[model samples]
Target: MRYGCFLSEPQGPDAIAGLRDQIAQAVADGFTSAWLSNIFGLDAITALTAAGVQAPPIELGTAVVPTYPRHPAVLAQQAMTANAALGGRFALGIGLSHKMVIENMFGYSFERPGRHMKEYLDILIPASRGEQVDYQGETLKANVRLTAPGAGFPVLVAALGPRMLKLAGTVADGTVLWMTGPKTVAEHVAPTITAAAAEAGRQAPRIVCALPISVTDDPAATVERANEIFKIYGQLPSYRAMLDREGAAGPGDVAIVGDEDTVLARLEELKRAGVTDFVGSVFANRERTRSLLIGAAKG
Candidate 1:
């Protein structure tokens, strides 16, 4: 399994510079990849561009940037620039964010998100490949051509539901999943996504699972921290349904919290379930982070 770390774009004094330092530290710590979360803080593309200049050889990616926030053409432009700045080591992970985040936070209409994403990809893929896109859909319409030749960055969709997974298999390079447990990944996500890819005559689609992990002696305290950090997801209907189907009562149940051996065992369980990549969201301690990354790299 490939090991990575998620850098939160914390908003405060010198946030962008702090992000650059964090990315540099993660790369120095032997992380294969460093991912930036797309949210209200620093724009992921800009932050990554700065970090790309300071960091060497570490792959950079967005955990996800929501499709609702911008048109595909716009995203394609930004992604191409960032990828170029990073010397072609940026992965663009796009998704339809939750209704509350889109509508309530960003003030966008959250109607028919699955359909919107399908249409969005239709434009995004072509544009990211530096082709002209003249497309119209219920939610978005675009007519633009990329200025650069092409970034050719791999695109991963943040997919969960059946239809979206099928779309990712058919069109995208892979899927990026969060908060999904091993059982659901094995029984529901892996088979369906790979089957769809096979039906489309494509190679097996990549399954990148982002699981919150912490190597802590105090497992209960670590679980509590996970619960607090991911509490908002439980209230979101889509994520709630996903967790329910996985037999996870809450974020605490899904978090990987234990000693080094236990955490490695859980990660092995995920790999056995067909996860191609593991993006570790380390939240317990800096020492634990170093231990997990070293262990994962050696493994």
Candidate 2:
């Protein structure tokens, strides 16, 4: 499995420059790819587009950009532009962000999220491929043709549930998972998505598994810190469902925290669970965790 790192956002006046430095450092550390999350901060795609230029050719991807805010046509245009800016090394990860954020914060209806995503993909996939899209679905409608420089970059969805996993495998290129454990991936995610992809005659799907990792002397303390840091994920329904599937009480339960050997064993387990890529969100003992991951990338 390919190993990658989740690039943390640096908060400052020159945050973009800081992000570029981080990407360059990741490249220096021998990381193959780096991911940025799209939270209530700088836009991930825009930031990556700007930061990735100075960094030498390491793959950059958005952990996810919410679909409710940007229309698919607009997103395709932006993603293509960003991909071009990054020398065609950008992966667009899109998701139906949680109901709380969509409804409460964004004031958008979160009804029938699965159907919304399916319709979103229906337009997005073809549009990203530079096709003339003239499709109308219940949740979305697009009638436009896009002429973009970076055509055909892979699109992955933050899919956890069966319907979304099916959509990810059959329609999109793959699935990008966060806060999910190996057991869930082996039993539920891998099987469901793989079957859907086979039925659709598509190539094997890329399952990119991302989890909090720390190579620490105090694993228990790290777990406690992780629980506090990522407590919000335990409440998000999509992530909550995956946590439940893994039989984890919370996000901390699934975090890979321990000595080097222990962390490597956990990564091996994820690889056995059919993860094509592993992105480490180093929460503690950052340098050591990244060292291990960099070695794993070379292996």
Candidate 3:
């Protein structure tokens, strides 16, 4: 099981250089991959492009960029360019973002997002392969081709529900999961994704599980910090259902917290649950940096 690190672009007045240094350190520490979140603060693709230039040999990717914000062809071009800039080490992870963010913030209709994503992939995959695509779906339409061959960048989908997982299996290289626990992964996620791949006669899709980690003797405090970090996700119904299935009272309840032994145990549980990769978001303090500690564990 490969272990990786996941972090957002740093938050502060002057954060770019600091963020680059953090990415460099993760690469130097031998992490298999490093991911950036696609959110309001920073442009993930740009950050990753800069990080790729500074940190050679580290796999860089977005955990996801929302599909509603950009057309599939545009996203394909951006991803191809980034993958080339990164020397063919970039994975393009895309998703249909939350309805709240899309409908309220971006003012795009969020209904039938799964269908929209499926149509998006119909264009995106072929476009990434440098093929001409003439696609017309209810929500999207495109007739485009890349002028040059893409870097053959792997596409991962941010999938949670059944329909989305099926689309990922049919079209994408893998799935990137957030806020899901080992038990729920074993009982729900892995089975659904694998079954879909099998029905399609495709190879089993990669299952990259993103889980919060905090190596602390005071597990309660660590959970508190995780809750604070993930408070917004708790309010979203999609994520809330996943949390409930994992027997979590809230988002923090699924977080990997405790001493080193306990944290390692949680990680092993994920591995046993058929996770192809583990992207850990380490929450730590001034006294004990969980990122450094968990990075060391990869060795």
Q: Arrange candidates by TM-score, descending.
A: 2, 1, 3
Please identify model 2 stretches exceeding 4 Å from their true place: none
Q: Which stretches of candidate 1 lie over 4 Å from their true place?
A: 10-13
Q: Which numbered prediction scores highest in TM-score against the true structure? A: 2
**Candidate 1 residue-wise lDDT, 1-299, digit = tens:** 67788887767777767777888877777778888888877778788888677766678888889888787898999999888878888899988889888999989888888889999999999999998889988778888889874369999998899999999999888999888999988998899889899999999988999988888899989888999989988778867777987898888778888988888899899999999888887777757656876668756
State the TM-score for model 3: 0.94
> Please, what are the lDDT tens digits per residue for candidate 3 over residues 99-202?
98999999999998888888889999999888989989998899888875444988999999999888898778889999999998999888988988888898
Error of 2 at 18 (Å): 0.6
- Report backbone clashes per prediction: 0, 0, 0
Report the Cα RMSD per candidate. 1.6, 0.8, 1.9
Q: TM-score for every candidate vs. truth?
A: 0.95, 0.98, 0.94
- Candidate 2's displacement at residue 201, Å, is 1.2
Whole-structure CA lDDT of model 3: 0.83
Candidate 2: tens digits of C-alpha lDDT, residues 67-171: 999999999999999998888899999999898899999999999999999999999999998999999898799999899999889999999999999999999
